[model samples]
Target: MGSCIICGTDVEGDGRICRSHQEDVVFDFRGNSPDQLVANRFYRGVVDGYADFGVFVDLAPGVTGLLHRSELDVRLESLEWEPGDDVFVQVTGVRDNGNIDLAWSIRQADREFRGELVHDGDSEWLPTDQADETEATDTAVETEPVEATSETEQTETAPTETEPTETADEPEPTETASEPETTETASEPETESAVEAAAEPADSVTASDERVTVASLGDRVDETVRLEGEVVSVRQTGGPTIFELRDETGVVDAAAFVEPGVRAYPDVVVGDAIRLDGEVERRRGDLQVETEALAVLAGDDADAVETRLAEALTAEARPEGLQPLAGDEAVAGLGEGLLDAAEAIRRAVLESRPIVVRHPATADGYVAGAALERAVLPLIDDAHEQSDAAYHYFTRRPTDEPVYGMDAATNDATRMLQDRDRHDEKLPLFVLVGIGSTTESADGLDLLSVYDVEAVVVDAAVADAETRAQVDTLVSPTLESVDADLSTGALVSSLASAVNDAVRSDLVHLPAVSYWAETPDRYVTLARDAGYDRERIAELREAVALEAYYQSYQDKRELIDDLLFDDGGDLAAHVSAQFREKLETERETASANLVTESVDGVEFAVLDTDAYTHRYDFPPTPLLLDDLHRHHANGDAAATVGIGTDELYVRSTGDLSVRSVASRTAEIAPEADVSTAGRREGKISFLAGERDAVEDAVVAAIADAF
Candidate 1:
């Protein structure tokens, strides 16, 4: 025997405490038999699994209980539980079918049950004879209430050997000297409960008896009901603790003004599974529950709630064998890991985790980012009832360059850190579309990694080996050996479709929009089938390109939506006309004033960007260079180099390394002050005096770099 941790008294074992302190002592049950188990006794258990019907909890080996949805006080999906988590629950029943029913216990934390934990049970504490006597006494006590309140005034009563007790005013010993001491002491057990029941009120309902959902609360206004659910959000508004509670059916705010900003319920926190008894009322044009009582469902009951939620989530399977939007073999082969990437993005939406999409400020990048925005926004709207959830959960930022660099990385880090400190937000999942593929982005990627931020890099560019380690998911062309000339939009459009297959048709015109030249046959057919002719598809490309160039930083969501999704085709037509006019004018100007040369048997058409072209006008430097190269350059291995006062923007028919040129130029013409700037733009800065010597060296350098 051991002494109770509370007021000193004999306990059967070290884990045991006296009956008066039983509620204070949380138990860890070892036995599984319903025969010895006391109904309504809370015990610690592990969450086993979830089912659509409810969560299954393992009390012990061969003992499990169901916390049915009918018993849920909150939304099933709102629960933030993973399997194997510990929780507390009360065993409501061990039925005839051997199905154990559990109720959510509001008291979840050890501090709430502050006494020492005991691992003993009634059967474990008693000998066989003593155990039988205890069981009989409990049975007799249960029947006394019914017997005492009989309709029949003439009641048959079993007589026992006992001395009569005195009135309450002058209480005396109930047992006489002649009475057997053991029998009288045993009879004492029967009267204890009878006396307690008579003293306790009849109308007072047990808090553990009933639980209801928020959806059913509308009909129950002005009526007090017990509810169980996770605290979605806790706001201390200086006047009250407003806990936003969500159940499977709906959400309701439960207000507790007693403690005001002092935290009315100190133990209550966001994501806690709690049971509350409150009167439903309409407050300021919205429904709210004025909480009278609150309990944190802890230990096994908490685990059961989460376990059930997990099971239900598991049962709702992700869509599998999703067909790629692009039906090409190379794209299909590259899509091996696309499904996993999509599921991750989709889960972030459901969890309400913020998503930051970093895409290059190009038509291809804009279209890809737009496709995901189209797919994910609807999901965010559906996942959360809040109208602003999409804005809160999703963000798309355009990169001025194709790579995720230090500048971009610093901006993202600053925003995320501020968000964490100000709003306690979850670190966002960084989705790099058409960006973050080379060694250039390593420093930026490393910065995000320090905070353990998860990232997904989706690019058509063949990423360097080092880039793979910096991201969670790297969907790049290099992974698949088949190096097809696919655009970034082609890759992410299909990935967006996989993220939400329902948006597949909406993305049909994207693949065709990505390729500025030689629009692929497969993608062209896809656009046509979706009712987008060549003219319509070209307009979208031009429209995206136009918008992509102007902001070059912001995600023009509404304008892009009208260009991409609107059937009127007016925006696309108007934008495409402007794009053609500006592009043609720039191309003609570049064609007129261009220096053509050949070195080491390779053709080179160089344009002086600062001297001949409008530096700040329509058709950005990169776009103008691409058009100049394709239109003015010729031969099998031709290249266009736009030489500025210090920088060289190169567009080529083949791979060329500016770093090699920079290294070689330093050796040949060190006075040129050559250095690499942007890898994606193939940008290299050098002195203008070295233009003649630098141009000659670069032509020879391109030959070797290729």
Candidate 2:
């Protein structure tokens, strides 16, 4: 009913593609049935393994077919193929014995396909041909070699007549019999397709007699054991298929190989509860089960496993209470909600689901995301037995804008889809720390919603009304009507503490480090008690702010971690010195260029932004204006405006909305061509010729509105 996301083709089922482009598109093949692959279609395949007979190409997980040597146009050894190299192929046929036949394709590169690749959850480009191929059953008619020789005997009997040479005719049958090993070697590939075909989706089945827990697998080395649980992940090596199977007790890897690079059990997928029988054994140093059989369990037996996991998880996942570091009651009340949110993240780690922390590319955003990362990573390591679990489980990404825009959403979608398709990995829990609020992020959230990706928002910005419906959890002071100037870092630091109470001491200085100026009294008290002096807090703040401005979009992970957490204060001191130098120089120059005027008892300090300030430099106009407003407050009568030809940025000691000023200008100087639209970043626009009138009206409006 809908159009394809790519190619805009009118599609029938699932809005995927039309019949023509389907053959051209590459898919993350979920091996369901051999019939799902259309007849005589080309596919993109990964080189699985090679044998003296031929090469094996993996079309999808648990689904591999063979390319016999005769099917190649050139010698197999001369093809220059390595394991895992992606190549193009054509399905020649599917054997009734449950095997696939592949032919060497002339167009071997992915770029040869004109259609877009439909990658992700399961359809692999497998072509289904008729079960039987063209049979030339005319049967090579041959005369008995003895009869031809007997004709020579008859000629001998004739005594004088000459007979044709029967010797040449006698060798013809031998040549036909020894023509090539092609036909004999063709059936040898069925050895790699040894597993039984799985045709129907099974519902819950009775446990096999050999069933045992994964924890007991190590004890049963060399013994046949049947284990049942969900398929946590599936990975195909050049040699064997490694399936990470997790039962309630623990997780163990089961290695299955019909042949090198061939999918062992084509029907099993991630998230499918399965019962498998394998021989327990050790390879290298780790224990792995040599799988003999695996079946995808369905129905109530599958539901039973999931329900048990859910019940066990839900019990341990919920937090006991709220813990507030801040003394304010409003913050304390919100702390309870933060605890619940923290538990969600902690549970994701325990459940082996990935966590993605998205924050704005500012000092506050970085500190917030880094704080959560610092807290959650250790938990991931403790929860999973693998050393790489921490890296795989936790990710902290810095977004350019403070809103969840389409770009960020698209990036997350693309990565998650690939993981799900290739590795059988689960979707990530999006922990939107500072960058997800307001109606501007609705479209971005809608995209994630399509795949059911969950999000957690912790911010201190004024939230849009629609933002609540978009997120699973929204933690913001403004949303609760708590008029506190807490930064996002400060709020998330509290949540991070609730995530791991042991990391509380490590984050003592983070809240204070998030504030650029006028550090909150509560945070200052906490930082002082944690042994960080006023000078150290300022150094951390300025250092991070300087770093935040330079690469703005990058995570700057290890460097930021060392800056904020290193016991030695050298990094912070060095960076903070340069930070203060640049900011102070810009401030002094901006002050020198300031033009002062007052209208109706209101003061206005207007600076030509393009000339006075280094617009491209550190301390962006907003930060610069904040410094200017604080530094030039001689009884604070009105506001300071940084005027550019295209726009003006305003900062006032009193309550200010530039919209009010633009509205007044429209009435007074309607011919001035002044407008207030597209000014969300606290800036307004006006005509260059109407400067005097716009300024006059702005001053008058500020005087009247405030």
- Top of the candidates by lDDT: 1
Top-TM-score candidate index: 2
The per-residue C-alpha lDDT of model 1 at residue 337 equals: 67
lDDT for position 185 in model 1:
54
Query: Per-residue lDDT for 1-706 in model 1, tens only?
Result: 8765444588775434567555444456667575555576677788898889888888787788898865653445545546887777778878887888988765453322333232434432211112344444444323222322211111112222233455333222231111122443565543443233222321243443567777687688878888877676654432345676755444566765332122456567767877777677764335677665677788997786667545533432244756777576666776666766786787666444689999988888898899899989987776554434577679999988757889999999999886665343567888998888788788999999999999998887778899987789888776446455788898888888888888888998888989889888889999998898888888888878987998688787767887888649776888889999999888888889888877777777888888888887778888888877766775443788898777778787875666777788677777888877666678887887888788777777876665
lDDT of each: 0.69, 0.68
1-706 per-residue lDDT for model 2 (tens digits): 6454334667764445566455544443455566555546676678999998889988887678898887775667667889998777788778787588988775453322333333333332212111122231121122222211110011001011112346421122210111122343334323322333112122222325756887676688878777888788876542346677877655677766543234557667788888777677764344677665677777997897788667756765666665665654555667756876887896787567889999877778889998998889887765544444666678888875646889889999998997787466889999997767766678899999999888988877666668888888888766347555677888888888888888888998788888867778888898999889899988888888888888676666667888888648998999999988998999999988888877777778888888888888888776788678788634454788877766677777665666677778678877678765322245667788887777677767777876
lDDT of 1: 0.69
Runs in model 1 lying further than 4 Å from the true structure: 1-295, 308-318, 634-637, 655-678, 685-694
Model 1 / residue 145 / CA error / Å: 39
Candidate 2 residue spans exceeding 4 A from truth: 1-186, 189-193, 197-227, 246-254, 277-292, 326-328, 421-424, 478-480, 632-637, 643-648, 657-701
